[model samples]
Target: MDTRYITSAAKPEQLPDFDLPELAFIGRSNTGKSSLLNALLGRRSLARHGRTPGQTQMINFFSVNDKVVLADLPGYGYNVARRDVAKHWQPMVDTYVRRPNITAFLCLHDCRRNFQELDERLMFMLGRQLPIILVLTKTDKATRNEIRKQKEKLKKRMDELGIDYQVIIETSATKNQGIAELKALVLDPHLQVEDENS
Candidate 1:
């Protein structure tokens, strides 16, 4: 069966004790993070719809197979109108990434725009320990050449940082592009070694 919804955690303390591995999805608000999560699970709308510039309030959870958990973190880059919201979310995201149970992080970015400095900072901060999969989402909205250009820019930045992520994927939930590869990457740990080895 395809992965289905199990439950959500509004707070880190409420998260259950699970020896199984955990993965997280994080990005700026409206970066299509929730859409990608639903796409990864092969469901239309499993993860809730977030605000245009959302508040960082919860660490939502889903059952990815029976062996692992998927944590949907509050989107980090909400606007200034929600300064307090960002304050609340920044700590939760920092803690979740540092948590012992987290296996990896799927850091989603919008393909149509230049990535922000904060994105780079977050990657720099988190890359120290957990593996991060840099996913360029909404590729369908951009031209092929544009996609290529953006990919190269991201690669250069990552290489310069010397923070090797397990892998980088480009996806468009609308076109069903790169969804299966992402799901497999998230579901199977073996791919990470081979991906890094190659």
Candidate 2:
């Protein structure tokens, strides 16, 4: 569980040279991307959590055990982003996603809220390009019934939209729920992509 900070890139050209398999964590603001990263890497604060929405504005990379690279992308869909970040967010993300080393995308979604249009649009765009696993974050805050209903609704909506996802994982960084399973998926060399029918 040795994780070290690498670099933060505000532009595509600034990205470091890394041959390691990379997993990008992306989601809407306040979806707990940093917290889940810390939990998954077994480090209390390796990835800094933003106290305010839209505070993370760059692509931050980290080396986990000298094995894989964890890329922390800034959260989207926040109205309060700094003007510069807002201007550059789209292109930076666009380039990063197309990088040859990206192994998978871990799309975090807050379990307490219903899906938004941005969620659908982002998933639709990414679905055809790379394997995406929808991570239902902050599950500890919701009741079991609430989580179940939300999952059902999300699946139904994805089906209707024809948005394909590799898997859906319920995670609670605070409670450490499903962290091990998620870690296994990320580190597994032969990460399997399950069809929508399965």
Candidate 3:
């Protein structure tokens, strides 16, 4: 699929005025969001993976085949101080998520570790508001048994939290695992922006 960078929005007004359905990618710092995005799009360095945690401070937008908009949200819960997250990041993220044009959210999680309090908080926030897909990233770092156990554990946590997510996708960006499934999900023709009432 064709993809191109649109623009980065540090404030609400700076966001690109696109009418296309949007998918927002979000997760904690170092969750391999960039790597996964690149893998999904079949392009290397399309999302620019950073070595330092929380390197992405702005919301980066990319157009996918000119049919869908992919919003690369700034990764939270990184090396940032508590005050910085509260004073800046939280409000910015809150504003973006409230927009009606967002079709769904791709929430990434690392397979090597259990979901933390921050991840749960995000799940609770987006639970009933919009469709969510809990993407387990870096699956190649763990064994097949370990991946299965992690998926099962995550399913239990989601069940306990009552998060009605669409699915849990396991992906290894380097090894090209589950990339096709995610890409198809993003490019599904049936997905459309939801209105406030519907």
Ranking by TM-score: 2, 3, 1
Instruction: For candidate 3, write residues 41-123 as lDDT tens digits.
Output: 87788788777788667899888889999999998887356576556777778888887888888899999899888889898
TM-score of each: 0.89, 0.91, 0.91
Per-residue lDDT of 1-198 in model 2, one digit per residue for the tens? Answer: 677899999888887878889888899988998889999988888889788788767899988778888899999989323676677888888888888888888899999988888889888888878757899999989998988889889989988998878888888999999787777866773567442322
Compared with the true structure, model 2 gives a TM-score of: 0.91
What does candidate 1's lDDT look like per residue over 73-150, in tens digits? 777666535776766666666666777887787889998877678888888777888667888899899998988888
Deviation from truth (RMSD, Å), model 3: 4.9
Q: Name the TM-score of candidate 1.
A: 0.89
Cα lDDT, all candidates: 0.75, 0.84, 0.82
- Candidate 1 has an lDDT of 0.75
lDDT-best of 2 and 3: 2
As a whole number from 0 to 100, the lDDT of residue 35 in candidate 3 is: 89
